[model samples]
Target: MSKPSILSKLNSGVESSSPPMAHPLRQRVPSTAIAGLGRSLDDLAADSVATIDPALIDPSPFGDRLEYDEEATNLLLAAIEAEGQRLPLLVRPHPKIEGRYQLAYGHRRLQVLRILNRKAKAFIRNLTDAELILEQGAENGGREGLTWIERALFAKEMEGQGHPSKTIWTTIGVDKSGLSKMRAVVDTIPDHLIRSIGRAPGIGQPRWQELVDALAIDGAIKRAASILQSKEISSLTSDQKFVGLLRALCGQSSLAPHSGRREIRSSEGRSIARLSSTAKGDVLAIAKAESRFSAWLTEKLPEIYRQFLIEGATSTLDSERPATGAADSDGTMVVISQP
Candidate 1:
């Protein structure tokens, strides 16, 4: 289901009545914080409401959205101009900075207040880092302001900050497996590259996974870097940039493997294994034509691969003694090595 737009959230006056009217402007922080994933915007828990200087407050260390919508901001500016800042921003006394405050939520409101050169109405509390993030999540929750990659990036931030896996799961509202997939993408893609592509609100993990696979090919990251810096992508939108990068990369790195084949042979000129590639994937077939060796190969592949990874790809398993084991009672034992 599509998430409700910021405009829809703005029109929902089910919580509070109109306030007195205000003006516009913006900056966001880089943060990994999200808590109370189901909380509503107007329902933040606070001690009291008072007006404070927007300029004195800084955005939270964690961020939610990838990019702000200018049209949405204009709509927000018009609304506050008529309603007079009905909802109060959530803030706390800065833990480190003596004279300043840290904003928990209401980033857009704070921006507008800063532009109007007016003080912001806010609920001030002495909040810990965790608590501040939760308050911020409460404000952003149910708004669907975050895109798929944005959530992944936010999840990456949460893990980086030492938040336990369970905490991250609850905060981001994703399962353990979901978090794992997000980590894979963030781990494979460089941070600056993700920021360059922007939010990619229209793109999902599957398409992003394509880029991940393409990048895994040797020299693919360099190819991707070149594509990102090209003049063609420089003028594209965020989603457009992603499409262009993926298209360029697919043509360069991914296509090189298709319609390719590698056939191994023994010193005696006997066939060993035939490796063929297609759009679907690579297929490896052993010429032994014996079920026992195939079974042995299947059972030992993981162990062989694990050793290769642990020791480094430069080292081969050919030097090791051949694998040995008895087969099923009716079948013969087969010895096979990485050679």
Candidate 2:
């Protein structure tokens, strides 16, 4: 499918070639002309279109998007530079701050214009909190559209803003059942972790719910977060980051096929542990040469785990009694992370 611009359907009614300075401002096209009755993007009147200095405009208070794709954004920048900005952004006069405006949509266009050092063309409207969010949702939903998690996060944001469920459902283009599932996932997981995971557009609702269910286990949050904070986590793709955390939380082995052993190295590049994976489980063998370190690790296991339980409680879903980890017959210890 062709990518949609920020204006979406509104671009059809908007006049091309910004008129002269003395020209009359373009009047608000009727809602019916843009979207038919009862559409999410409809009803908000865009009273005028004007060219305003990009410096005077501010970001939207109710943001619906997480982040823009770099490739897509660069494409937009190139298009605007070559053809000039064809679509106008939507903004409202700042309610409290003087001589300032708050954006409703078209953030990408505005940012690109700022880079190009050009003024912005915009649809000016005074919108209520509900209307502002709805417009934000409609513009996004109508345009390139949000990923599953983005829609869920947007639903949570709307609810926090005091918008009714009907508005939330229609705006995000989800049914009641879908909205309930979204709320379930968003409410259970920490927003910080979800945001850390990024849009994960390839991830679907089933995988999200699986993450949620895993988070319900005792010490799961701290366990998952430790993995997330690990150096390897940052280098991983969004989906890989999520799957790793989920596996850690559920105490499940990696879903990937067994690929022999991978080395666990110390900061100085010495091999400290050898990790081998199987469908049934994984084993971390402390190097025989480092007997002192292995003994230290064994002695510290209980103390380290005590700390994990105490800390995990803070981020735990509910009050949970500390659970014990399974050990090999030789009694060597395996741990998620050391405190």
Candidate 3:
């Protein structure tokens, strides 16, 4: 036997129209057969899947994802075009507005279907805000995962919405320790900086922690901001941009201290040499002098030492001999007698 066609099977009973408005507080179970797979026939009657117009579904207001990868989305679109949507989306009846639905997960699929001008294959269920967030978190965490910073920001946003700590932890699939670390890293880096870096998938907790450490130094935030705003960084991919910012922050903290050396100048105040002193020795650097003069000094150094030795011997001889001289009319002096 051949496998059943998804389109024919799902479209059998449901008409392609806006889903009926549900009570604001009322929750409904899954109505689709695929959703009823693990449930009983009674449960299937209450909730079942349907194909609905794409225009009627609104994205989850509490959605955690801030950015989407365009290349990946395009690939998904191509795949769906060739082979119809294999997995169904999960959506709830819009809580406030009538005749619309809200998405729990499958945002990318919904977007592609909308762009293709086709109906969305979805499992319709009425869920509360907490249930919606839980499903969204689970789907993202288990599938194409959010980057580390993305998850951090999501957790931060959820907290800001008055969700308790335990709920946030369970929603993102992290424990207390992991959640604490995420919050710390997110709090240390400015939100604008994180957003500017974009979604850096594959980057993990350790590197982000290192970034937090670097930003703790005085003046580091200003330097990081300058790098992010640079033209060179503007053209890079999102992951490359994050790397560039990380390198800039790390470089700023690792600069070497300056040596205490002063320049010696000529009479005209032009620098001719440099003098530096250390515990080991004193150094006189004269590279600033003319090259010809330097070469001449190098060549005459031996001769100059020999002349100093000869002068020392003559001084000793003069000390040993007595003075005996005669003066001529031309003022020439000569030794007349020797003792």
Candidate 4:
């Protein structure tokens, strides 16, 4: 399908170019009719369109980082000061029935000129409401770049504005998969890591996502977050400490009694410990090198397995009976079954 024109897209809205000036004493030239050599400020104001105060103008629709770069602002101000207002900014008229006007673009220039004029006023063109909202959404949503914190906050605001997570991801123009992973990190990570994720270098969305996946273990999430926050480890890249830390988090200890480390994995609801040994003793070497270890395991494995089965059976039997007829803690006396 074809895309709607800007006005048609905004539906019932109109756009205006006038943002309220900081100062009321400013001269405005209408973009429509301007060919004279040297029009006086007052004559320019008289010949131009309507005037609106700066205070009445809405806050910038683009959110907090509006014209955030001071250097860029300075450059624009210099250009305007040197060349005067060459092109007019686009804007939409007030949507409300009672409001005066609203701005669509040229906010920075309007601000700068108002700073220059300090107290001048002049009229500007009107635009539709649809145009104004579109203007705000475009400026507010389309960012050139973002620091980690800024990106997170942007995501948060988008969520708050009832934008779907997918829509927010698409609107920001980032990879949908990467954005999905970042959202997962934001959702599942510990609070400390959440706060630290955007502030630390090398802790980008991908790294955070990986960390979240690694730390999803029970009780380990908080511990991992604490270790990450430790001052000694904070300087390390998230990736540097991540692998070893994740290994540690998986129940392997970096500082076990052995020269290497201990690895632990779950097996049938029991922790299986793998202990490493480095021995110079010949006897110890023989013990490790021989099949004796495997032989011992083979010999005892069935008994151990049978013991667990018996214990499980007894536990189930005990649980199935009523507590009122259960044996005493000391097993001195008991009824074996409920009536």
Q: Model 1: which residue pairs collide?
A: 20-84, 21-84, 31-61, 31-62, 31-63
Collision pairs in model 2:
none
Regarding TM-score, does 2 or 3 come out ahead? 2
Clashes of each: 5, 0, 6, 29
Error of 2 at 27 (Å): 28
- Name the weakest run of 10 consecutive residues (lDDT summed) in model 4: 277-286
lDDT of 2 by residue, 72-181 (tens): 77888999999998878888889999889999888888889998999999888888877787778877766756789998988888999898888788777778999999
Query: What stretches of model 4 exceed 4 Å from their correct place?
Result: 1-53, 61-68, 85-107, 118-134, 140-148, 164-167, 181-339
39-118: candidate 1 lDDT, tens digit per residue:
33224332458788888898888876777767667878888887889988878898888989999888888878777777
What's the TM-score of each model vs. the native? Answer: 0.61, 0.63, 0.57, 0.35
Q: In order, what is each prediction's RMSD in angstroms?
A: 15.0, 15.0, 23.2, 19.8
Write one digit per residue (lDDT tens) for candidate 4, span 1-339: 443443454554766678988989867764211212122223233334444555555543434231255555688778878877664544445566356456655566667666566322444545454334333434444434444434554565566556666656554555677566556665676555544433333346654554566676567677877766766555655344554454345443422221233343332433333344221111111123435544654576576557646666455653223222222234322112211
Which segments of model 1 are wrong by more than 4 Å? 1-46, 252-339
Q: The CA-based lDDT of model 4 is what?
A: 0.47
Q: Higher-lDDT candidate among 3 and 4?
A: 3
Cα displacement (Å) at residue 133, model 4: 6.1
TM-score of 1: 0.61
If ranked by lDDT, best first, what sequence of candidates would result?
2, 3, 1, 4
